[model samples]
Target: MKKLSPEILEKLKGIKAVVFDVDGVLTDGKITYDNKGMEFKSFNVKDGQIIKHLRKNNILTGVITGRDSRVVRNRCEELKIDFHHHGIEDKFNVFFKEMSRRNIAADQVAYIGDDINDLPVLRIVGLSATPADGHYKVKEEVDLVLSSEGGKGAVRELADLILEATGTYDLILKKQ
Candidate 1:
């Protein structure tokens, strides 16, 4: 347990919920398209494991994305993340609604996102984060900048960061 300088360690301790924006933050922002207007995405397995651990710890986990896809829904279901919002334009609104529904407050939330669309919610969250390869604009305003790139282990990296900061990661690992 080391002292946090940016007040990051303190803020992280109070985080009861963590929100993620899909596409850039989770999937490397790459969209694979087909001839008939279909799209595909890739999600890392390590990401699922980490999110599962978060859930097991009872720290809320959620996903918000602008695009609606069955792939996203199915993966969330498999990961046991029922708090998800998709096809959303005003992400902040959806985020607040979900928070209210879950009985969570603003200061209890941590948001991780990339791109301009994500900046609004990121600004208001207790702690904000972005992946290493995220847009500079997005990265510049965040509270934490992860070393890992998105879709290539970024989610796991941040998840592990949170767990370790909260002093739960090592406990879980010991149980395993």
Candidate 2:
């Protein structure tokens, strides 16, 4: 994980929710097709653990993806995310509705994205982040540029920062 600056650390303190983009943020931005025309995507268990840890500590976690897939649904189910809105044309639409429904302010949310479509939500969130391998535009716009690539603990890095900012990381560590 990269060292978070004091300003970024302060911003993270207000974060109560974290939203993610599935394809490039959760997976390695790869979509493999088999001869049988089945699609496959690999996800990191470390990322799953991070999500579980955050939720256990009362941080809301959610997913918003432009693409819909059974794999994504399964992964979100396994993580037990608070919100799972996928296959939307405009991500910010779902973002606003969900946040309003949850009574969470824009400053209380953190959004991680890796492409142009993620810009809208990322620009509005309290703490915006992107993976090391994220697109140039996305990287340039994010508050935190992670050291880890997608599907390789990028979410874990962000979760660790959030846990640390909220003074809950050590508590989770002690329980282990």
Candidate 3:
């Protein structure tokens, strides 16, 4: 993980929720089609592992993606994400609605997106981030450019930062 500046850490401390864009942010932006026409995507267990801790600490989690797939749905379900929306064309609108419904302010959320489609929501979040392999345009817009690539440890990296900034990292560890 790259070093987070004091300013970034301060911003992260206010984050009450974390939202993600699926393709490049969580799965390396790769989609596999089997001969049987089944779709598959690889997700990092390390990323999944930290979600429960976040929830335990009262930090909400969610997924908003343009594409829809059973694989992605299953993963979100398994992780017990607070919100999951798929096949969304206007990501910002959906994100805004969800946050509004939950009474969460834009400045209380962090978003990680890897492509242009994710720009609208990313720009409004309290802290925005991208994977190391994210598109150049996206990397430029985000507050943090994570060292790990998508489907590797990008989400975990961000999760770690959030946990630490919120002063819950040691609390989670104490249970282990």
Candidate 4:
């Protein structure tokens, strides 16, 4: 894949909101079931911190997962994600809503996704990013392909790039 384009980087700099697709982009794309049928997902601590950093800088962040689970809801709550849309078969709806609610236009939004289901939003968003583990079709359509796999700090990587471009990453990290 081509390296991230300078044009793409410039576009990412204007992002005031970031959105992600959950099961894959946030959880390594693996679904585990317990004896009682409870579902579980693993989220990176660093990703959480990145989201906090973005929010602290007045940038809005949220999630739109295809599956519905308390685990996702809890994670969103922990991250203080304002627009949580789970069990969304149609990602564009949630995507458009979040953009409108945040008062951020499509050109000012970046979306991280991992599979064919994410193609629509990825195609329309200004900056589209895919994890290393994303499906081939999804990667083909994205503007940037991350070196890290989803749920393995991919979100953090994307967040860092966006924050850096916006010139707010260092400021946020100074508090750490």
Q: Largest lDDT belongs to which candidate?
A: 3
Q: Which stretches of candidate 4 lie over 4 Å from their true place?
A: 1-3
Give residue 113's error in model 2 in angstroms: 0.3
lDDT of each structure?
A: 0.86, 0.91, 0.92, 0.86
The TM-score between candidate 3 and the true structure equals: 0.97
lDDT (tens digit, per residue) of candidate 2 on 125-169 = 999999989999999888988999988888989989999888998
TM-score-best of 1 and 2: 2
Candidate 3 local distance difference test against the native = 0.92
Candidate 4 C-alpha error for residue 134, in Å: 0.5
- After best superposition, candidate 1 residue 149: deviation in angstroms? 1.0
| Better candidate number, 1 or 4, judged by lDDT | 4
* Candidates' RMSD to native: 1.8, 1.1, 1.0, 2.0
lDDT of 1: 0.86
lDDT of candidate 3 over 1-176, digit per residue (tens): 25778899899899999999999888988899999999989999999998778888999999999998999999999999999999999999999999999999999999999999999988989999999999899898999999999989899999999998888899888989
**Candidate 1 structure, TM-score to reference:** 0.93
Candidate 3 C-alpha error for residue 10, in Å: 0.7
Candidate 3, number of clashes:
0
For residues 1-176, could you state the per-residue lDDT of candidate 1 as single tens digits? 33456588888888888888888777888988899978889998988889999899889999999989888888888888859888999999999999999889988888889788999999999988888888899988998888878887878877787788889999998999
